[model samples]
Target chain A: MNVAANEKEVKIDTAYPYRTLSYFVEDPPTGNRVDRFLEAFAVVLQYTDYKSLLDSYCTTNNKCNRCAVSCPVYQVTGNPRDIPCYRTNLLLEVYKRYFSIGGWFKSRLSSGIELTEELIDEMAEVFYRCTACRKCSMECPMGVDHGLVTRLGRYILSLIGISSKALKVSVREQLEGETHNTSKVPKVALLNTLDFLSEELNDMFGVKLDFPVDKSNREYVFFCAVSDYLMEPDTLMGNAIVLYAAGDWDKWTIGTQNYDGINYGLFYSDWHLERIIQQLVQEVTRLKGRNILIGECGHASRSAHDFVPMFGGKEAYPVVSFIEYTLNCLQNGKIKLNPDIVTERVTYHDPCNMARSGWIVEQPRTILKSFVRDFVDMEPKGRANYCCGGGGGLVSIDEIHDFRMEIAGKIKAEQIAATGAEIVIAPCANCKKQLKELVEYYDLPCKVMGLHDLILTAIEIPNGKSAVERKEEAEMFAM
Target chain B: MDAWIEFAKGPLFAVSFLIMILGLGRHLFLQLDGLVRRKGRRLLKAPWRKIFTDSLSWVIPVRHIVDVHRTVLFSVSSYIFHIGVIVVPLFLADHIILWERLLGFHLPKIGTLLADVLTVITIACLLTLLGCRLFVERQRGVSRVSDYVLLVAVLIPFLSGFLASQPQLNPISWRAMFLIHLLSAELLFVLIPFTKLAHIVLFFFDRISQVHWQLRPGAGDMVSETLYGKEAKV
Candidate 1:
């Protein structure tokens, strides 16, 4: 709850661009287009199962406003509109105006407020203000999910093609484009990256390691956030090393057709959510794998773990998070790590998506306790953890770089600064990137990394070779 | 005035009470109908039992007690206010007599002094809550006209009943205060289903979706048991 003193800090209150989210939207909603807005609302009413959800959120006066205390955005900005309840009401007000029985009477009898493009425009701006971390749902006595309402708002807006262009274009390439992934990495590139990682890892450890690819009927099918292939080689390498320790090439394989696991759809649109999940299931079914092992991306893991059933139905495989799989291996004594290494003052950031439901929170913490010498926890960590201000796909947009650091992530920055950690091990790829920016932006004296990145550094090799020895040997060879 | 009071309590009260019950029932049924329609459509079944049990476990609002320095006072006020709203109306000597007359059943009534004390405390709590909304900038900003209306509407009956019970304290005529009390209570009963007050019954369904809906398949009993200790407790 303590923020570090900054001479150049942007005040969240009474500041224009700091409080305001600036996005280059593809079709910026213009005028009071009630007809188009109503059309989309009607479609949402028919398709989405949010009628019951919006009912409680719209109807309830559970207005204790305690969620403001829980919301990092509201806390930093001191803006009433930034409150989670207020944000949810932005959508619920629309729902009440058009859909509800009370709204039916009120529209004719009372103020006669109808859905307008102006409200939708406000929804577009405000919905993104939240990281959609969902720490707020914990405080609402009515348990109205503010995050779900945000998603529902985004979903309806997406129907009108009014979502973030960053999310839109990436999703475009993922679903319909030639290379069906958000990063648009070609098959050759994915394979080459893995091949190069295998070579790099093998040369360091003096052990032959080939990344299993395109193998049929394997026990585990790996689907990582494609960005991990390029940006986080160590996370992929750690997972590969851990999985190999658990079994071998016979046990796991990455599919050639669609190995990318990122589904930004989880953040915004149900159309994309279902489509991406169906595609992920197809890739798994193509390989006939026994289980789905998702790599170090929180939303990616959540989409597979939770939405697979919602979207895939019969094609749903047992989705295991990379952390969970690695934890299982550690628990089973399949893998070992040297405990004395990674001596820095370390802390973990709970990816709001994974930590919200108590899914991946304790697993990573438990894994960290095994190796980390002085691992500290944020004051209100796990389930109640503040987001890195990069959730809900806010990290992907370069335009909001300062916003993500100065205001959106201010609370998280303070949480880290309070712990005085030299290293922050955020397991999610998005979290790591945002926290890295946060460390740089705020000048927090720390380094940001993935949990598996540490595991890669500390993991004991099978052939009696320690990673320390390998690092020394590589350093000696370089000399 | 006496006749109007009886009229408000008898036929009018019956009609309004029935509307509240039926309207709220319809809302619950529709919500459940939506959930039911989408239930089997998805692959993994939500841990309904655990979710509901955990939700019921949190009914006392002890979670906020952890932040005692900050939100505890407000949460306690809300907790007591809700209790008083339900308990005072049900167990007050006059109301129990009315219930006995209507239902032909034996009922217990609280002492008038105790009931008065609770009514005062509850009124203060409700005022504290409303004052927070009205005075607090952030709370006022998030609030709608309907929110303010709902709180004042709820307050009128309690205020009128307390004043009527003590004729010395009544600024308005005793019969007039009594009439206002009966009519206001009737108005609340009629409006309950149409407004956010419907959350009285619907909180569970709202809670279930947000709390345990994201639970991975087969992790329900485990997580619930670990978090709340055993799944089947009410």
Candidate 2:
């Protein structure tokens, strides 16, 4: 069956299913080249030409075997059938068979293997073997999008009622409002987060911070990843220090409705992603905050930057990241750093989102370097840098721990090792957490700290509003 | 035979020069356009296109063609190939003379010794590339008919030029060699945009795409591959 017809039957019952847009239908016009090929081949469909033979064989990720060197999966497995380049070549052969005379007659006359269930399963395995990491994307010179091609293949698999278990469950949960996304916080967790923030800020900056939770109708609404509340207590507290130091405490309030900064639905489908964003944007609007300051999370920031602009269009809200706010405050002379607190061989691990994905790479680098004494750069710094392996929902996949470490973590470890820096400051919580595990696994000496941790060590709390002041502030808000 | 030599020296050289400049201009323009526009897929999309585009920027698309060591060696050879790709075609006196004939333009030559040195370097680079392709493990496994065809296409011109420059070989041999070289060079030129060669133009484009994606609000929307929630994009 054609790809379109096959995709309609796809079912997502897994943890992360490929959620097709049940709400909106789009006939993603097949690409320019594919359309031309179809039109040209239509004339000789029954003529037993290469057009027919090649068209039949141009199946996605089914194994025509052309990519010889750079496919990361094939690089790991040494299997031709598993590589994406091979699939590309298979399609190329179809192009060659009809257009290039030599390939045409031979392919048309040959009796090729028919598309069977076993063949489909094998193709799926080959397609799934790829992490969609984009290493091969850097290697292939044709600008062939192997990852997207694979996604298309995966989407096709979904249509055939063979969607993965993980994809289905995750999509379903997201749709049903069971989105335990990065920002989703339970009552106890929210309370604990506030308490921790209060303690950390007081202890470090001597600022008694009153971080209010679920306080509706404030001028500024701050959103943070739930993990930041639990693990990176310093970040929450650091934010409190800035707010308290800036004396904008009453103007800023945490959302009583949703604290999760992430919009994971963006990866699975477009419309569902739009809904969550609309809801968040609407909530922030209703809160009537002059500005929405997103905490140190990459993808969350990305969702705001990309989707908010798209969805909000002309009336887009001014959503700013903490880093941006910090830089702005520093630039405007709103805050000053105590140089005595800044002493370390520190190098910023530009979170893939903040640096490459968010265009906030330079600000953090400049800010970190300005505040720190010994600032060094990672070898493949910035956009060219490798992933933390634990990114994308892979960090939560504990069942596949061995695979994650072996495949993804290994590449990251090597990249980190090449950096030869002392401390790798990861601004995002996910990167920080993943790097923490990988550092321990590889026995690396580098310490992974949140971006605010360094800031916390530096910026001094205003007089009379020290740690005690911060603690008093927290108590007042919590009460 | 002399007429063909004269024409090759004059007309063919000029035409080839024009094609190179035009190709280079188009290539560079496309590269800049790709950077500013930043219209490329993400890791979850078609990765090969990204791979292909990125690979071209470094002037080497397929790194797996050689072992890590061999890759370094091949890159070094590629630098030599680049020098030859430029000098032997654009700066040779014969080429200049040909251009002068075709377009009435006279490009200065760097001298005979430099030309001879460049030819030798170019030949050595080609030989090195060929050696790496044949001997490298990953390259050997993936090598196809097209790969061999590209190699021959390069070698024919270099060999013809070397023979043509020699006083011992007949002028006919030189003429025949030049024709073969012209044909091969033209084939390589025409094939560039359609084949993986376009990556040379697309790499910069991909880099810009990376820059653009990094700046978006959902930049941290990294989906974790692990089953647990810890390593995911939180």
Candidate 3:
């Protein structure tokens, strides 16, 4: 599946800095300071942590400005002040004016002009425009994390009531609802999805398997996003087949009630985050599950791997990413996959949530290599991987699509072109959706396949089932 | 005359050297105090391997020197300036006379004509570089007023050396070159503390900032807990 056109360098628009700047200027921090002792400390420590970051990473006025020029957001807006360099300078000015000797001398000279509410408002605007993707961190002579810096700045902004509406709503829902703003999904919808997946699997491969949803007391529990079930049913079906191929059909059950693994709590408030994850852990424990496997979602994986250990409070149980667990099963002969199932030339996109935040880089590659023969690697991969433009809730704001596609996907489009691989194996839900938009906009010929979909396609079934049989099984169960 | 040049040169070099050391020492002391008070442990404890191995790391032990790209013009200019600075003082016949008086030994002159030609070219390049820096838009944007002043400070030494080295310009070569070159270099030494050129002192602050954070026990979990609490179900 060779692409007809090469989208090697998609140009990002550098307009709209004023709008971004204005938004930051006007918007007050949205969520309340979470009650958790650690969170309060984390929120309070944001000021010192940010200063430490600057002191450690950006002390040089000369060397640390690489982020100002090369940043995608800055490139899009053409505003130096909104970028990390000047944003940092804003903080440094605060440090000096309020804290340093030069600041004291200048104050004495100027009759003591203190940092006011107006200053905080302007600085907040400058700070939040950054998505904190850490792309500029790659170019800095000092490996400074502007992403963490921006996040801390945004957190501080939240304390002052100046956060984005989309982010705020998402945070509110996660905090109160213990779900990522997704409505309470109908059990029938999930059951229908499982039935559909079962029929698809039967049609594609001559294997009859049950993908049970919300079954109590299962030995193994699998969690997936509700969005995957609705929009990307194949992602769900793919996971079903992988589980089946791994010979865990009898042991595993998919949760029917609000199976979304995405924790919006991670984005805004830490309090709701703990509540959400603890509930998930409780569900697993109540079911008496031996192992819990998370589906192909980036933020979800971050919740499981990063947030779970910290906030989950106890050594709950064994929790693993679907990719890792499936790969292990395949290696140990628990699951057998045919090479012909995934014959296309494919490349992997490392999700920011999994790659940068979770550090789950190698497992997906190992899984892909076992199934994909012509597996190619994109340059600037691993921890240095670019965002899919959808991770930080940017894709939800439909108005920013044009800029987001051009700016965020610009580098990703180049990485895809460099590979020349026919299929892109992005194991993330948001990354998959964004790539779909990119492939359409840029006219790239490659088909975007979720990691689960490819796994389902290649997994060796018990009977001699064709691809149609598996699809039938999936559809049948889904219905 | 030899004894007089020797006596003047020794005091001039000593004064200039002492000023540079004192300026650097005070700058470092302040930075250390700030580091301690601010708790810049990551930068303080940064390992050498982490400094060199990072993709974005450019190791400059000194701070005030500016970037390699931005400083290319100045560096190239300084090459010529430095040649004049060192050779004019060390290789010139008058300089040798002062050295002979001070150390009681006179080394052979390789080629006085070639030496004179090199000094002239070095001084000319140095002047040209300084002129361009003042005029160029990209250079001027980042340049402070003191940057031009430093360039002139550097240029005076070369200009005086060139004038002193020529046969026709030689009547007052010893005193004029010695006085102008020594005074200009000394003036730069004084101005360094007040100028952006003090990055020499600031470079250590920048390098100290370059120290990478090695993930400590509980640090990763602590960050996660703070960002996303344990019970977050989304």
Fnat values, one per model, are: 0.38, 0.03, 0.05
Clashes of 2: 103
Give the CA lDDT, 0 to 100, for residue B29 in model 3.
76
RMSD of each: 6.9, 11.3, 8.6
lDDT of 2 by residue, B14-120 (tens): 56556765765665674444433433232232234533444455564333344222256665676668778777878888778755765677888878888888888
True contacts kept of 2: 0.03
Worst 10 residues of 3 chain A by lDDT: A29-38
CAPRI-style grade of the A/B interface in model 3: incorrect
Across residues A1-479, which tens digit of lDDT does each residue of candidate 1 receive?
Answer: 46654676554333333323477678665665567667777666654455666776677746678888778888777888788888887777777877877788877887866565556667778887778888787777777778887887776676665778888889888888889899999999988998899887887666778888899999899988899988999888888888766666579999988888998988886657767888899989999998998989889988888778655667878888889888888998988888877779999999987887537878999899998999899878887788999999999987777678877898899999999999999888899899988888778899998888889878887774687886577569889
Clashing pairs in 1: none
Residue lDDT tens for model 3, B1-234: 555556546786667657777876776676676556544443443445534444323433122123224444554555455566556656777668756765689965546776777777776776766666566544443444445666677667666766655658766756756666666666666666544455556645554443322212233334544555754222
Which parts of model 3 have CA positions greater than 4 angstroms off? A1-48, A61-65, A68-70, A74-83, A99-101, A110-128, A178-192, A206-226, A249-258, A265-292, A312-319, A356-358, A417-420, A464-479, B1-234
Off by over 4 Å in 1: A1-21, A27-32, A471-479, B38-44, B47-50, B67-69, B167-173, B211-234
Model 2 error, position A75 (Å):
8.8
Q: How would you encode candidate 3's per-residue C-alpha lDDT over A214-315 as one tens digit per residue?
A: 677677788765578788877887787777776777778766444667665555434445666776777777666766788998878866665565445564
At residue A438, candidate 1 shows an lDDT of 85
